[model samples]
Target: MQYFTICAMEDTDLSSDSDLDALINCTLLYAATKFKRKKRIWKSSYLRKRETHGEFRLTSEFSDDQFTNYFRMNRMQFEEVHNTIQNKIYHEGSRAHKEITTKEKLAVFLRYLASGNSYKSIGYSYRLGDRTVSKIVNEVSAAIWECLQQTFLPDPTEELWKQIAKEFEQRWQFPHCVGSIDGKHIVVKKPAKSGSSYFNYKHTCSIVLMATVDANYKFITVDIGSMGRFSDGNIFSSSILYKKIQNKTLKLPEPDMISGGEKELPYVFVGDEAFPLLENLMRPYPKRKVTANYENKVFNYRLSRARQTVECAFGILAGRFHVFRKPFEIKLASVDNVVKAACVLHNYLRMTSTATNVEDIADEELLSDQLTSIRYNNSRNSRNAFLVRENYTHYFNTTGAVQWQRDSILRGKY
Candidate 1:
């Protein structure tokens, strides 16, 4: 009930010396203070008595039970917990990422991500061998992916789908919308034998990651094995998504909003022009003149609103993993795992953060233009809009495309 405050260390930061001895000693105290729930703890110089032969040492006045009850540790017990996390929790075989503990590994990774530090620089700071530092980072990153994929992503259940449907109505004014689908390229170090196969519009050789994010900006699906040289269109057509659509294996719920309609409405997913048009897939109509003025703009506007989640999700991923910002210079096979880990960590951070709400974007032409521009650039290979047109044609046949036509008219149709 009471908050306790006191400095555990003095002002000189003597606890942060380069020696391993310092790490052992300081980590012990850090674990002790943290375990005790002490709010203020310091590590620095302790004043010495000039009259004494030895430097003066002050006893920390703690409750007699503080050792057993508060710290829950004896000297041996403290070392065991410290060793467990150091050896087990963050022990990625990667030489780049090794540190004292999982917490330390996370700190290093976040620091590297937040500030683009060279491996040598990070190694120097963490007192790890340079090569060891690289392995540490990669291994720790893999662990993050393992944890997140296991904890966060699962096939959405009916309840989850319903929640997604509700969010679409409130946030994007598009009912029955489950998630936004898109692909992003991550720059990577060019492999020895690979050539134009990895080259992308960004003028970099990289891997492409396809993702589906729900209205809340959480990834619901992911496929991350294709080369960056592949167009989003090719990635989509060749992906498991296309297979699922073909096999009818993707079990989707019927939208309640369309329950009363006589039309044979199936569950729908939204994507850009790069993805194949299917009965369940909805994309913008091919660039066409609006017979009903504004209809084209309105449809594009609505589609853009629903599709923004994938863009934001990618932004968060890239911003949080600088490894993605720079092309990786590792083995090509390892690239998939790194991309997978970055995405999983991204979802993990989003779930753990206090800010759970997706950023609200204003409905402005400038924002639309920016989104359109990025899409065009990313989808340049699929410039013909073949997939989008195919889907629109199918939907037109099914719903008579009349309601869509009417809606287009009311909105000055696209």
Candidate 2:
């Protein structure tokens, strides 16, 4: 379609300077009709019937399994998310068009995250424009984070830390372990002129998602959106969580005795080799060191079991949401909030879900090395750090020893 702006002008010849000036100065006719460039058919037949086939239709008409398959959550879970954020995402309608319902906006947002499809493709399925779909994604993602973070993913309290430690001991037999910390690379399109800032060693543009997870695969605290070019240790060291822990401002519980141990030991977080060894953080012994002795192998095995909580969390996240399975194809500005919203939603679904296995959003769908093996250059730490680790090592090989740990380590499981 073509467009023309029509106006009334004095009768004049193009050859004359006066006529040219008159043409340039002529006022646009107030009553003149201007043609606008628009699609000849604004809504196609398929588009008009989108309500019968789009996510709305699927979410409403599909059976429980089908519903979960499409949206990555059951209807009850989806409604919980909708009810929490509907008001925030809601907009008043004007004469031009009826406001998009919060439910529809959420459907659009979920389709984008659940499938990692392009906005244009999602818009096509929803009978909306690509720009509108993009807007909905950003708006709904913001609402998901702001409305849900406090309730679903609150910062850990001192009491909560103690509970986490107890659970870690009970569940994984790793006493005094508070939480598991790790980082995952969330790939994205490189921002314009960002240089190598977001370029990772894997040769992809990405951002880091650093999370501390509790025993039940729930995120206790999370920090994301750092450039992927940064190492895991650098991201951990620079994060506010690290700062708080180092300054003793996070109010971690005081040292306490384990079931069979006489000495009080500081509660600690479990991480892979990518993190520093500190009095309050335990990482695996180096491969060479672990091979040298039985005690080192036992400690590494115990810590690896405890640290897999975050790995399982990331696995379920990438499996159910699927957005993290590839580079996020949304706007760069929206990537952080999108990831934040997913983390918040993961917490919510975990609490609400009773579903099991591959079809379940809460299942521990552990990914292979792809999501778990991002490592950094190892650096040694303090003498006190070594002492703290040795205390745990001694406990694990002796009183903290489980029947299967030694066998598992001898089988080269660590």
Best by lDDT: 2
Largest TM-score belongs to which candidate? 2
Give me the overall lDDT of model 2. 0.82
Clashing residue pairs, backbone N/CA/C < 3 A, model 2? none
Backbone N/Cα/C clashes per model: 30, 0
**In model 1, which regions exceed 4 Å deviation?**
1-99, 254-264, 289-296, 356-414
- lDDT against the true structure, per candidate, is 0.56, 0.82
As for model 2, its CA RMSD to the true structure in angstroms is 4.5
lDDT of 2 by residue, 1-414 (tens): 012122224356668898766565443332232323333555557665666676576567778988878887888888888998998999986664556788999988988889988888888778888898889999999999999999999877889899999899899999888899988888888888999998888888888888999999899898887888886578888888889988998879998888998678999999988899998988898888977798888888888999989988888888778777777777677998898999998888888877554634444554663353456647669898898999998898788889998789779988
